[model samples]
Target: MIGLKPPAIDRIALLAAHCDDIAIGAGGSLLTLCSARPGLRVDALVLSGGGTEREEEEHAALTAFCPGADLRLTVLKMPDGRLPANWDEAKAAVEDLRARTDPDLLFAPHPGDAHQDHRGLAKLVPTAFRDHQVLGYEIVKWDGDLGRPSAYQPLTPEVAEAKVALLQQHYPSQRQRPWYDREAFLGLARIRGIECHSRYAEAFHTNKLTLDLAGG
Candidate 1:
């Protein structure tokens, strides 16, 4: 399971149906992990977002986001907004990634997301990484898909700012979206931070959680 412990968890997989899911979800933790751990391996997979200038921005954005990590990015050419129409190809892509990495931890979109692409990726992840710990991260949106979160990751003010800055600087194509403002990012973090008594935080939800309360 994903936790604070170190046990061959150097390899992580960030899988999503679109380009920015990785950035939107675990971008801060990724920045923290790569900078802190030398030679950390991160494999980023996007079921779509290829063959376009956006992909180039995504590549540059991710490289800056995961500094010091041995990052590998793959952008699948599946059609966006039509994930259900391409189930076989999408599932196969996830299985291909799973076979190659057998990742220790996986960051994927929360299934409850209103976007079909995000929901499809969320469902496909568990089937491939059956043994790996999967953390479902939220993408603050106007679709009212934000749900009650059960886990918290405390973010320093610096980390919080960095997350917003990277999003704003890199993904200019999305700037016009009503939900793409810094307020949405910072505001959600502030709300979740309140949940965990931190200055700011990112929240996650999981279907299966392993707790070692016996140690406490």
Candidate 2:
């Protein structure tokens, strides 16, 4: 597979419908990017889990995932699994995030996600962050919504293990879920890696991209 890199990525934005969504979807990519660019600004917004243990978990999890980057996170109290019903609040939250940071790249759920909350947030992303590159990260779930992703961020074996370790470490509350295990995480990464000719990777889908083939 041909590999392409963004010309510049000094800052990034992360959006999720629930607290652990970002970590489950893009944690490896975050680790890869932040470790490479120290102090990179990361503005994150989650629609639910504010003022709860989940929010606390999200803060600690993102801090660890981001490493030394300038990570600013907001977790709202929008009812989980009810994003479609609370559309206005979610939209305003996304718009507010847009006002605060002009990230060169964005990570969010793919529009085809089977979960309603994830799919809702994904649809709202382009309405606000028009012109920015958005990488729609996938969450492996019982719903079986995984699809063919065109973009891949190959992860070193060390980074892949670290990502899984961080997820298991920071989010104690999620361990009870049957699917939330090392095998599931590593299994998906390994599959994506095969798709992209790597040992491990995080895959993403993009709706639009403007290429600079001239290398200007």
lDDT tens digits by residue: candidate 2, 114-138? 9999999999999999989999999
Runs of candidate 2 with Cα error greater than 4 angstroms are: none
Mind giving the per-residue lDDT tens digits that candidate 1 earns over 15-92? 877888778887777777677777878888888879976788789888988887788999978888999999999999
Q: What is candidate 2's TM-score against the reference?
A: 0.99
Q: TM-score winner among the candidates? A: 2
Q: What's the lDDT for residue 120 in model 2?
A: 94
Worst ten in a row by lDDT for model 2: 1-10
Deviation in Å, model 2, residue 148 alpha carbon: 0.7
